[model samples]
Target: MNMHNTSSPVTSKPEELVPSRYALKIGDIDVMVVSDGVLPLPTAMLAHNVDPSARAAWLKEMFLPPDAFDWALNAVVVRSGSQTILVDAGLGFDPDLHLPRAGQLIKRLEAAGIDLSSVTDVVLTHMHMDHVGGLLVDGVKERLRKDLRIHVAAAEVKFWDAPDFSHVSMPPGFPDALRSAAKRFVKEYGSQLRQFDEEHEVAPGVVVRRTGGHTPGHSVVRVASGGDRLMFAGDAVFAVGFEHPEWYNGFEHDPEEAARVRVQLFKELVETKGLLVATHLPFPSVGRVAADGDAFRWVPVFWDY
Candidate 1:
């Protein structure tokens, strides 16, 4: 047998090896989770307040690398009646960070047959670069509809005005990068912002609600229709959060409050039995929460092929 199949057919176009988008329905509404790609970060970003050995043990339990790992970055697109809402844009190109794997949202959206012009509104969960940088990508704004309404917590925009980095524990250069991204985003698209005080319905069943924690204006989007429900939790919850609800993510501006919000959201999920899709959770992050002793358990929904 030949060592190499030199005669194999070659195609002009190559497709991705794995699926990047997963679509599901919540009653009458349609939701699709699109992966922007992954960000490799120090494991210490997971919980700054915990002991190194404890964190290492958790990593061991999960069979993950103890030092650093790739964090999944997800963005959601929701369709309700006549409105198309984009939630939490993924990390858009940051050359200085040398994170070339991330910031693939725009192209991924195109691959998924989602057009920027079709988006009528944008519901931002927070002002973090990973959550809003996609909008700042070159040519993105020009492609968006002129009347596009970007819904966000008024508090979020205000917080970025004079952001407080004293509490966060991110890796070096993160704070400055985040600050620059937020400032540039505001300067570029300030006119389109639709700042809301507490909660606002983007469409018939899609409501964005503020639950300040990770950031002063960090929020979550709740989608409900008929009898089905789902929530797109921004950074309030992480993969480690379900088991270690008290652990503080390095990105959280107020770690204590973020922990509280995570537990509270878990209780709410347990009570309502709503599907959970968070920004930092594994790809296609659809799941339900169950009370497991004093902690919580992540019950991922079966893939609906």
Candidate 2:
């Protein structure tokens, strides 16, 4: 994670000018890390139980500003044999949101030479706006490949389809938006929408495991071929999640439960020596976890240029 130098002064860029696509081969599967763009997350909102001084020091050490954190929106595309699986749909084609930094995933995929129509499966890790927004590209309903199948957790679909208004506090119109999106997705996908309970094999080598907490049915997608393994941990943990598994994000459906799940996932990664591909981590968010005392640490794998 500390791949960059801390002595350099970070500059605010109007747009991401670098290439937002990366690819790697895991045995027979081709995994591509695609970036939608970067969003500014307020630091105070995710501080949780971390000490102010310690948080500030960690930000400075990571060469980041203390005020706003750069949260990346990443989606994974796994090509195993004849199956092309897309892990998540990023912030889809939206121009009025004013968040010009995001919503570039569709273009990035095209640049990567990926044919959207060839996508056999679209597996949503969760229905977060950033994650599911890309279900439609350019406002076309059928933009999602003609021969595509969608996989989602039964709990997740049920939770969003009939969200409990009680004990729920969200920005104005957000609840309605969630419900509308969930309904529309179900209706549009129709028989193509497949929901499962705990674990499901979306494809031959890609499996989705339910690890709730961030959302009612949040899950992780594991891609395995031969002996190589990689986990697309969709928001199970973020950049500092490994180091501070107890620090819960304010947006979590259950803060305490999210922390517990984070710890569990970290332990499993450490034991299995698996590669973690986080959605909110920095671009090309591929790394490994290690146990450090009672907590854990993130060690990003070196990428060959």
Q: What is the model-wide C-alpha lDDT for candidate 1?
A: 0.91
Model 2 lDDT tens row, 1-305: 11121122346862445868777777677888899998666775455566778778878888889987678999998887778888998877445444677878887776666767878898998887778877755454555566678888988887876665443334445566666666766766668778899999988888998998888899999988888889999988887776777776755777677789899999899998988898898889988899999989899889855
| lDDT agreement with native, every candidate | 0.91, 0.78
User: Which structure among the candidates has the greatest lDDT?
Assistant: 1
Sequence-dependent TM-score of model 1? 0.95
Model 1 lowest lDDT segment of ten: 1-10
Reference-based TM-score of each model = 0.95, 0.87
Q: What is the lDDT of residue 242 in candidate 1?
A: 94
How many clashes show up per model?
A: 0, 0
